[model samples]
Target: MNAAQIHPLARSPLQSGIGASEPDPDAIVASGVHVIDVETRALQALRPRIGAAFVAACRRMLECRGRVVCTGMGKSGHIARKVAATLASTGTPSFYVHPGEASHGDLGMITDIDVVLALSNSGETEELLTIVPVLKRQGTALIAMTGRPESTLATLADLHLDVSVPEEACPLGLAPTSSTTAALVMGDALAIALLDARGFTSEDFARSHPAGSLGRRLLLHIADIMHSGDGIPRVGADATLSEALVEMSRKRLGMTAVVDDDDRLLGVFTDGDLRRALDEGTDDVRTTPVLASMGRNPKTIGADKLAIEAAHLMEEFKINALIVVDAQQRVVGALNIHDLLRARVV
Candidate 1:
C-alpha cells in the first residue's frame, strides 16, 4: 500500500506545524517559568479576596447538617471533585455531584440541609444554572466560586467566593489554567478552616484512612501486633543464660523477657546483653543465671499503647526489643523492632 493509504491521517512534521528540528531546551524552560509566574500571581490576587464571603461560606459548611455538595461543569467539575475529596478526607463531610448529571437525576443527591458549592470561571455555566432553581426551591444553601461578581451564578448564590484571576496561564488566554488553581486553593482553605473549627486531630484523620501508612502508625496498638502467649520469648529469672538463649532462638525475637515466679517482668536478656556478658568474660552461659546478664529496668509498654510509641521507646534507648506488661507489671507480651517492621508501624 502507498504511504497515505497505510497511514491515512499521518502528517509530516511541517504539516503538523512542528518544524523538522529538535525543540530548544532554553525556550521550553522559559515557557514553563512563565506559566509558574502567571499562576503564582493569580494565587496572590486570590488571597485578599478571602475575607467576609470566604468566612460566610465556611460558617455555612460548619453548620451544615448534611454534606457539602460540590458541583460544576468542565474544568470546574474536576476541581469540584477534588474539593469534595479534600473536604471528605478532612473533618468536613462532603461529596461531588456533576451539574450536568444533576440536571438529569443526580439532583436527588442534594438535600435541603446541604450547602452546594458551585464553580464556574465566568459564573455563567449553563449546566449549573439549569439546577439552581430546583436547589433554591428545595432551600439548599448556595455558595458560588466564580470570576465575575455580577454574573448569574454569583448573584444567585447566598454567598460568593471570588476566584478571579488577572489572566490565564495559557498563552492563548482561553484555557482554564490559573482560574482552576485559584478555585482549588479556595476549596482547600474552606476545608482546612472547618477542620480547625472542628478540632480535627491526626488520630481522627487516621480513623478515616485505616488502610494507609499513617493509620497503621497512629491506630495500631501493642496488643494488636505484639507476640503474646506462646509466641512471646520468655524465661524464668532462675533460668540459665543458655536457657534464655534457647528461648530467644526458638521465638526468633533476638531477646527473651526474664519473668518472676508469678510471671511479673523482672528484666530482659537480649543479644546486646549477651555481647556485654561475653566481652566481660562472665561465667559460663550453661551455669550462670540469666538474671546476672539480663538488662534491669528495661523499657516496657502497655498493651493499649500505640505501636508507634514502642518504636519511639526503642529508638530513644537504642534498644531493639520491648516487653509488653499488664497494669500489674506482669509480662503479657513481647515485641521487637522486627515486629514493628513486619506490621509497617515503623
Candidate 2:
C-alpha cells in the first residue's frame, strides 16, 4: 500500500511551513466548528423524537424470521449499505438492495417473512415508490425512514421512523449533511438495540470476522503459535556455556532455556548474557556451567494462555522470547517475537 499523504494544513497556523498557498486559519477552524455544531443540534433534536416508532421498528426486526432488506436512493443508499453491514456483523442477517433494482427482477429477492427498510430523505423517491406496491403484495413488512411522516411512503409503511434534521450543515442547504448523519445514527441505534436483544457475544463477532485481529485475539492460544517439542531451544542447567551456545545457534531463537534434570525451568541464557559474561572476563565460559552465567527467574507464560496476552507480556518485559511452561513449570514450548509477527497477532 502507498504511504498516506499528509494534509497541507495539518501544522499550526503560526508555523512557517511550505505549502501551495496560505489560507485563513481562523476561517478554516470556524467552518469546521460550524459544521460540527449543526450536526450536534440535529442529533439533539432527534433525541426527543425517539419513541413508540423506534421501539416498534426494533421489535419487528427482533422477531423477523427472514433477513432485513435495506433499500434506498443516492446518499441515503450509502448510509443504508453501512446499516446493513452493521446489522449483519452484529447479529441480525441483513443486506442492501438498491431501490432501482427492485423495479427489474431483483424484487424477487424479497420474501414474505422479510422486513423492508426503505430510506428517502424526501419520502418521495420515485424508484422506491414504483416497487412499494409489489413488496406490499408479497405480504412483506415495510418500515419507512424518512423526514416527512405524511409522505406517501411513510403513510403506507407499517412503521415510520422520523430521521428529520433541522437543516443541512452546508451553507446553501443543498447537500445532505446533517440529514445523512441523523439517518446513520438512527440506523446504529436500531442495530445496537437488536444486538442487545439477541445477546450477541464477542466470540460470535470473532466468528463473523475470523480473518481480523479480533479473531486472533479471541481464538488463538499460546499453544497454537508456540514452537513445541524439538523446535524449543533448551539446555540442561549443568550444561557448559559452549553447549548452551550450540543449542541457541541451532534453534536460531537467540536464547536457550536452562532446565534441570527433571525438565523444570531454572534460568535462561541469551546472546546478551554471553556479552555480559565476556565483559566480566569469564574467558573460561567454554567450560563454565551455564547456570552460573544465566539470568535467574526468567519470565515465562502458561501454554494455555491467549497469544495476545503473551504478546503483552513480552512487550511489558521488553523481551523478544518467552518460555512456555506447563502447570508443573516444565518447559513445553518457546516463542520469539517473529512467531507473533508471522501469526499477525503482534
Candidate 3:
C-alpha cells in the first residue's frame, strides 16, 4: 500500500501537512510493534524452561563457601556486571571478570572457594574456554548459561542453564538481543534465589549497601539523628513560655520538651503553641508555665525505632519533629524532618 493508503507494513499511513513536509508515521508504528512482539516472545518463552537446573544453580552458588566469579565477553560482559551487583547486593559476594582479562592474569582471582558463572550465547567463547581446564583442576564449581547445549563451555560446566531460543529476536538472526536479555534475567533469578536461601533481610541488604538510601532508611537509628543530652530542646514545666522558646531556638528543633522536675517528659511546646498562646494575650504573659501551653502526649518514638518510622510520624502528623524517649518515658533525644532528609530517608 502507498504511504497515503496505509497498511500494516506501510511506513507512513497518515501523511499530514502542518506547515510543510509529510512524515512516515505508519512505518514507525509498524517497526515499533514488531520490536515489541519480538521482545515479548523472548521473555514469555522463559516460563516453561525455568526447570530444576535453575534451582541446582542456586544451590551450588549458595553452598559455595566463597565468592561468585561472573565471567563473560562483549554484551555478556555488561550483563555480568549487573549479575555481580545483584549477587552482592542480595546475599552472595560476587564480582565480574572479563573473559579476555581472565586469560591474561585475572584468572588468579579464581579459587576453589569460589563458584564460576560463565555466559556465552554460542557457548564457544575462546577466552572463556581457555581457563576452564585450570578452574576444573582447582575444583571450582562451574555454571554455564548458553544457547548451545553441545557447545564446549556447556560441556565443561558443572551445571548448565539452557538459555536457548529457537532463534534470536534479531530480524536477520545475528544480534545478541534476545539471548542476552534471557541470560541477564536468569542471572537475576539465581541472585534472588540465593538471597532467599540465605534469609537475607532488608537490613542485611542495607549493610552491604551502606551508602544507598535503603541503608539510611534501615540503619540510621534514632540515636543517629536525635539531638541528645544538652542539645535536646527541653525545659521544666515550671519554666516560662519565653524560656522554652529560647531553648527551642538554641537547639534548632523548632520545639521544646516540657518535662517534670525529674526530667520526665510532661509535654511539648512549639512555635504553634507560641502563636496560640499569643492569640490569648500570653505573649506578654511570661509568667505562664511552658506546660500550660504544651501539647500533652505529643507524639513519641523509641530511640531504637527505625528512622523510617520517624519520617512516617512527621508525614502523618503533618509536623516537622518528634520526641525520642526511653521505656521509662524519659526524653532521651529528638529529631526533625530535616534530619531524615539529611539521612536520605525523606
> Which of the two, 2 or 3, has more TM-score?
3
RMSD of each: 6.6, 7.3, 3.8
Candidate 3 lDDT, 1-346, residue by residue in tens: 2543332342223433223365456555665676567666777887677888888898889788999999998888898899999998898999999989888899899999999999998999988999999999999999999988899999989999988765565555677877888888889888888888899999998998888888988898888888898888999878998899889989999998988877789999988988999998874646788877899979999999999999888889898989899998999999898888887887
lDDT, candidate 3, equals 0.85
Candidate 3 Cα outliers beyond 4 Å, as residue runs: 1-23
* Pairs with steric clashes in candidate 2: none
Give the candidate number with the greatest TM-score.
Answer: 1
Comparing 1 and 2 on TM-score, the stronger one:
1
Better of 1 and 2 by lDDT: 1
Q: What is the lDDT of residue 266 in candidate 1?
A: 91
What is the TM-score ranking, best to worst? 1, 3, 2
Top lDDT prediction, candidate number? 1
Candidates 1 and 3 compared: the better one by TM-score is: 1
- Could you give candidate 2's per-residue lDDT for residues 107-177 as a string of tens digits? 98999999999998999999999989998898999999998889999998999999999888886678899
TM-score of 2: 0.87
| TM-score (all chains, Cα) for each model | 0.92, 0.87, 0.91
